[model samples]
Target chain A: MSKQHESVNIIEVKDVAFSFGAEKVLHDISFDIHRGDYLGIIGPNGSGKTTLLKIMLGLLRPESGTIKLFGKDLKNFREWSKIGYVPQKATNFDAHFPATVHEVVLMGRYGSRGLLHRITGHDHNLVRKSLEQVGMQEYQHRLIGDLSGGQQQRVFIARALAGQPEVIFLDEPTTGIDEKTQGEFYALLKKLNEDLNLTLVLVSHDIAMVTKEVMHIACIDRTLVCHMSPEEYLKESHSEKIFGHDVKVMTHHRHKK
Target chain B: MNFLSLFQYGFIVRGLEAGMIVAIIAPLIGIFLVLRRYSLIADTLAHVSLAGIAIGLLLGVNPALSALGTTVIASLGMERLRTSKRVYGESALALFLSGSLALAIVLLSLAKGFNTNLFNYLFGSIVTVTSADVRIIAGLGVVVIVLLVAFFKELVYVTFDEDAAKVSGIPTRLINTLLIVFAAVTVSLSIPIVGVLLIAALIVIPVVTALQLRKSFLATIVYAEFFSLFSVIAGIFASFYLNLSTGGTIVLIMLAIFGAVMASRKG
Candidate 1:
């Protein structure tokens, strides 16, 4: 809302480092995410990709360095409604969990209204619009657990979208879903980013899929290996250092396309 | 005796009042505990409430109020212990459960012996329900219900997924701790009808039964309340006629309901 915020980067990470006990997961990682950027963070299983995402979301604090959201210190950033996060896809939720898709999506409005405040008509419209965005408006009355994995993931994303955030962080959103469903999910993300002007940061293990979809790519291993346009990343062949040489074989096919 | 005549006794009236309140709140809190996979915390806090009652007996204080105070603190402590890296989750509860029982034993011994009054708490004597006990249960039950209603969305969101709740800036730690506290308060308030030994049943059985039905969350809540209230009221009636233990009878009724529901679902 401020003139200064309009000129500021969506996220700024500087020299951030994190460790788990004796094992150092991230070392001196730095990157800036601008408005309207669809950035994909790709790495191997133990490569600290999720940890880095958690740090950026302020869920886990890095051992060293500073991170800012909306040009304010991550610790001091109070306007959480501006950011939405969809956690890992293996929800482990109860099969009989009593909540409907509509109820789950309405949760996104909670941060704005907070405790004791009722969800207003605007919030309901946002929930409906979010479900519509995910092409899940018809399934609003369905139990979340009753839906297929892909449908459930869409509902989860709709829950995040109902917040009406400027930026959304998704952690391995397509895992466990089938390949064809993954394509549709990516197309949905693309629409959300381009049409809604929503900044998107996604963590995924599928290098070929990520490289083709995201406008920018941040390849992270123990640290950030490269932050560049997808075209440059596909050409430079630096992905091997992050995802290993197998990634070169994967991206090589993409580069020819 | 007819059903109308059962209301003549003041103690039975108080018993119904307290049982009704516990019936609604116990399973209400239990549903969340079950969802969070913290169902065992209810059992552990119930044991801790027994210790509170023992300490209250030794100190000549109101056992229900003392149990209420003690279990609230223990519940907060359990929340901290639940995250202890050194102890496994169930093992942590085991420690509290056994430790609280041990404390109750020591307090019971210190008081010289378990008097008839003290014995009433261990197995529940709704036939001897005091006006003071009813007042406390009513007041505490209302507070717990109010808190649950006010934060229903946040509680459900957190129970469904804690990490997502935290990143959404929902004050997840506070809600998590508050939920445990509510469980503690529910256990303490329930002792008059269910007793410490059977209080966990009051909290868990209704919700487990409701889970059998394919219902929405709000419908599940309403259904659980209905089942719990039926068990409490019917158990009291059965106990009065058969001269059986009130707490044991109530839990037995609920267990029978749970078994029937599970069987019907399987069939």
Candidate 2:
């Protein structure tokens, strides 16, 4: 990585916490993600990963602490053109809802265009290019509900890419796809990081594949455990720290694999 | 009567103009209303809006003014009922519908001499409509259509994927409030033609008919607008020939169109 890329922080989350009604989901958490860093967030279920992402994106306000994006306060980042998001597979949307793939991809531009403006020629060009990114070019005019699972996921990624976002946060983008496609999905995300220099935050439970795919890994169980490089994460001591008593079982399982 | 006869005939032209304007926007709003599973809300809110018009009559004001004002309030209440976490939106619609009507009845019976022409607000008197009503409905229709065009993509996005819209930084709450207020304005205009009990048919029938053929959002809006525009005109003329109530005939035609379209889609 370039010295500037390594030094410049893209996301600075400080002492963040959140709760639904009264039940607190996340305790005090703090972390910093550098520009072009592909960071993976891993945790067991109900570990508040999704909530933390929502808080970072300004969809949910933390009970305490602050979030800063690109050196400015998160709330001040009104430029949606800078960020892309792929929510979990379940939220891929109601397939029965009427929209062509091209129209669906065009929605990424809606945030930047606001209410008064219509899609222009430039917007259409970007949509076409984005569809090509995820190999959905031929399905541009097809209804979204007609696509298979992997194709739908690709369509969603293309929709996010249409915004030309500098940073992408995907909440479990590989779910439900077969093992082979899941590997391919990771390769695509990695390509995005290297080609477009996009900063990424991925939340997933699959530790085995994530360490190979991402540059940085964070252990989150309702708090920021630590963030480290893939090499650091592979160390036995770090594995002991992350998995604790389960580390023996994990190592034995890895042996079987 | 000559070519200028309708304009020369005054009330005939006024009623036609008013019916046309209502027919345009009600079904346009109905597209999202049906999509978001809010069809029942529109139907129930029409009844609640009627209750608001009754309260206006009981208070001895121009029923439209008070009706418009109270219906706006009632529309907000409907949105709140839908959003409140403890309340299931469907059941809340039923509760609000019945509750608002009961309140209207209490206020109406308490007022002196309400049982007479007061019922005209329930099952509109289209022939009794005046030129002023025509102007208001037309003006409101223009505003509604303008907003719809300007906010088409945003509105569609919000209706289709509310969580996505919110996460993407769209002002979804404001858009939702605008929809409810739009529905209230639509209901107020429609009551003059179809009455409260049946006005929802004006909104639902055309959109439902259009849904059978439309495979895209853009097409859905076009077909919905066309269906309503022509249906209103046909219903008005049909009533004139049959010597019947304009709103009832319009809705019957709309339902028949829906039934025919459904059968065709099946066949």
Candidate 3:
């Protein structure tokens, strides 16, 4: 890929509006996700943060406007393998689901491998590499339900990584984990972004943590209230405007330059 | 008669062939259905198959073929209603289950009365199974197995997480439809040996028994296959000598295994 292509906007959302029955959730939402961008979307509960992410992921369609993925319209885009998704933890999965960690991660290759194609040794290697990246390679043969919440989260990330996606969309990835695990999770995301040059789009409600971890903050409350660098986001009054209160911006020691 | 001597009877051989085939394919579809909490769909389809059998007997057609046709169409309708959210899953199943049973009763009455052939269908008579039934069961069993194998990973992926599978471009809608269709076929093929009323038990009990072991998905399916085969084969032999209802004996054996598994797990 050329440098110009590397810097191009990979996702373009314009004038998107959505409603659930009679209740309008999002309107006039527009944003651009550039290559290698680490963007965090934060909003109040039921503020359509996850809904917007779902729309972008093609799990749901926008009522109006358009979404362009990889410079192609979302409807016409067929390259789903280029995108990975980690849904909200603990909500969408059965705890007793009988799948080994290795098997779960191998599913990431299913889309690219297509139907009737056998799983190759290369797919196993990629699954292993993905698990190693998340530091869960040793637990590959264990059932997914047998792992802790933090470990399960890591496995899910590994499953996403196995797809070798350029961009990953995470919906509240750290909702139920402990604070320490949440910190480590954010660090992993940062490493993937900085080391692998993977674009990250995270939907979260932890304003402070998201603001500290993400390069760009998109504050949403039924609309795109603000999308700017975190430095500018903190300096501006967008938090108060969206949250209906003053959000005290905490200063954390920057461990990484 | 000795076990070897039982094979001397052509009907016995045919019944075992058909029963064993149904045993193999039942759990293959059963595991997915059980895991999805869609076990009742099998029962619903079986009930729907009863109405189809009545229609076939009245119209002078192959009841198995007609039942397959009805159940397949009904399965598609059930899938649509479940996905459309217009009807709750259980309620939709109830509607079809009761409505089809009522239709079967009316049709049977119109046909003058339930004959010995229909009685065998209602409760299963392995002794009455013919060579034609064996061929049909074997042929449809291969189809169910092939479809399950070809989409094994995709079905597992969908069963594990439907939303994630859809987002990953797995064509989950098509997969879901294929599963229900497979269920329809399994239920219809099972009716010859397992009977209409007890077919769901044959499809479900083995899978439920295997779940008690808490094995991996593939291992669970293997265990369910073992349980199903054991029940079908053992029940056939015992029913042959004891003059018991074949379907009832098979289900009772499965329940006994389930009970033992539960007891062992508790111990």
Per model, the share of native interface contacts recovered reads: 0.65, 0.42, 0.62
Model 2 misplaced stretches (Cα beyond 4 Å): A1-6, A234-257, B1-12, B80-88, B91-95, B112-119
Sort the candidates on DockQ, descending order: 3, 1, 2
The top-ranked prediction according to lDDT is: 3
In candidate 3, the residue pairs with backbone N, CA or C atoms under 3 Å apart (3 or more residues apart, or in different chains) clash, namely: none
Tell me the DockQ of each model, to 2 decimals: 0.60, 0.43, 0.67
Is candidate 2 or 3 superior in lDDT?
3
- Candidate 2 at B44: error in angstroms? 3.5
DockQ-based class of model 1: medium
Model 3, span B1-267: residue lDDT tens: 566888888988898899999999999999899889999999999999999999998898889889999999999999999999988889999999999999999998998658898888888988777787788889989988998999998999898888888888899999999999999999999997879999999999999999888778888899999999999999998999998999999999999999999999998
lDDT, residue B257, candidate 3: 100
Q: For candidate 3, give the lDDT.
A: 0.89
Residues A1-257, candidate 3: write the lDDT tens digits: 22335478999999999999999999999989899999999877777999999999999999999999999999999998999999886678888777789988998989878888899999999999999999999999999988988999999999999999999999888867778998999999999999999999999877878988988888888999888888777777554654564344312222110
What's each prediction's TM-score? 0.95, 0.89, 0.95
DockQ of 3: 0.67
Error of 1 at B241 (Å): 1.2
Q: Write the per-residue lDDT of candidate 1 for residues B165-218, one digit (tens) a residue.
A: 777789998898889999999999888898888888888899989988867788
Q: Quality of candidate 2's docking, in CAPRI categories?
A: acceptable
